[model samples]
Target: MEAKENTTPTPTTTTTNQPELFTASDVARFCQVDLKTIHNWADKGEIRHFRTPGRHLRFRRLDVLDFLRKYGYPIPEVLRLGKPKVVAVDDDPVVLASLRKALSKRFELTTFQDPFDALVAVGSIQPDAMIFDVRMPGLDGVKCLERLRSIDTTSHIRCIVYSDAEEMKKNATEAGAYDFIKKGEAAELRDSLERLMGLERE
Candidate 1:
């Protein structure tokens, strides 16, 4: 049996503020599949896409990212648009929703309701920063931060503690939290994260 030929393109340096579009051929090249497979994906509504005025199939960058993430594909750097990735661990659904509303536009945000799950995923996510709710059911935020600090792969990730309890600040700091923010302070959290990630406000 012959090994499948790998045709993944080299990462490009193109950066754009506007939404980027990829043709079916580009998607095929990125996925290392036949061009017809991409068209079939579009036709089957497996991949979110639109048609140009000339009826040429086009896939938005975000849509492509979603598809790649869903299917466990290695995300190409060009599709990342240099956005700082962030992972947030919170038990409250409302808090997660609020965090998503506040931070999704500025960063590549991924949230987990379970701190344990976040801990497991963080190694693979390799986010630039993480937000942890101080009070969770199974694994509290401080322990989570401490665990990450103990691990070589995750120790370098900047972590911020989010909670209403101010008393946890010292403990969180000692546990290696990069910063601490009170819950409901979305603006402050965003600013702190931007600074931590070295991203200028747009």
Candidate 2:
């Protein structure tokens, strides 16, 4: 009897073989950095990416948008809206989502999880200000502030870090935080936000 022939055909990826939204070369060009720089950013947790089961790195287009919006890095000699961008970085997804939903109408708020990655976005987005949580996974609020000031791109971006701990607030402010808010009351937050945006404070 003849051996049964194998009938199952292996599946092939047809839809643009690239599962990644961007490659190192692509990121180098977009962020105006070298491929090595992109790699470095990845290593430092400056950029958020996902690892495939095959060990390939995949970047999110949303993350890229947030990055560009962070540095106020304008589109080169292209269509520009000239509106300001704002970034909110936190470890808690719930808080991040809530902030985005609440402030999406008024400000161009981009939310992120990792503080270091948020700084990377700040370089690209050039947002007018930033709101970050004191406690995060990678970089803490104070460290994030130091890094922001160190970078020319985000040197002027307003840094705001809030915490329930008064000690954290004091430490954050001393570390060059623009404003600190307690975890509760949204009233103070609203007022501070309005003033920062040059809106009439209520």
Candidate 3:
């Protein structure tokens, strides 16, 4: 009896590359919802998400943009281009110069020494974030923050209060500032910007 030789077949496998991920804020901005809503959607499995080791949730960037388009939410051209527009307000020329140098690489910075001008610019710029000098001569940072909050277009823009006075931190927070940093504290400012822009912290 001749025994038949057995032939083994190789199994075929397909690998899928995942799309780029976006932070909670990115999804919220695209969907025109709060960050909490993004979290809720992820929690309820209403939206596809990726969970990090620390339990942070990330959304598929393409999926989120598509979702926005489906719901008729406008996507900014800059966002599509992967650069965030930022508005910075400082009454000091030196500070403005420093900020321009510090943040130009990561963001499109539109700076104003006058708080009033900054307020006006917000409507046109539609920036992803803002940094305001807490001690501006006329309209202070807290007031600027409040004014921005009252405007429909600028209300959702994340704001950081730049101040040397430790006492003003609470006021800035109360006035809807997203974060606060001491003037000239580059590292703190960087951290805050990263957090606001959804960049991973160093």
Model 1: per-residue Cα lDDT over 50-141, one tens digit each: 88779899876656766887797876756645566678777787888888888877776777777776776777766667888788897766
lDDT of 2 by residue, 103-199 (tens): 6555556666666666655556566678877777666668777877677555657777756766787778877787898765445665666555544
By the lDDT metric, which is better: model 1 or model 2?
A: 1
lDDT of 2 at 159: 77
Per-model TM-score on C-alpha atoms: 0.60, 0.55, 0.61
Q: For candidate 3, lDDT tens digit of each residue in 108-144?
A: 6677766776666566656667888778687766777
**Model 3 residue 144 lDDT?**
74
- For every model shown, the clashing-pair count is 0, 11, 0
Looking at model 1, the pairs that clash are none
The best candidate by lDDT is 1
Error of 1 at 109 (Å): 0.5
Which ranking of candidates, highest lDDT first? 1, 3, 2
By summed lDDT, the worst window of 10 consecutive residues in model 3 runs over 1-10
Per-candidate RMSD, Å: 16.7, 15.7, 19.7
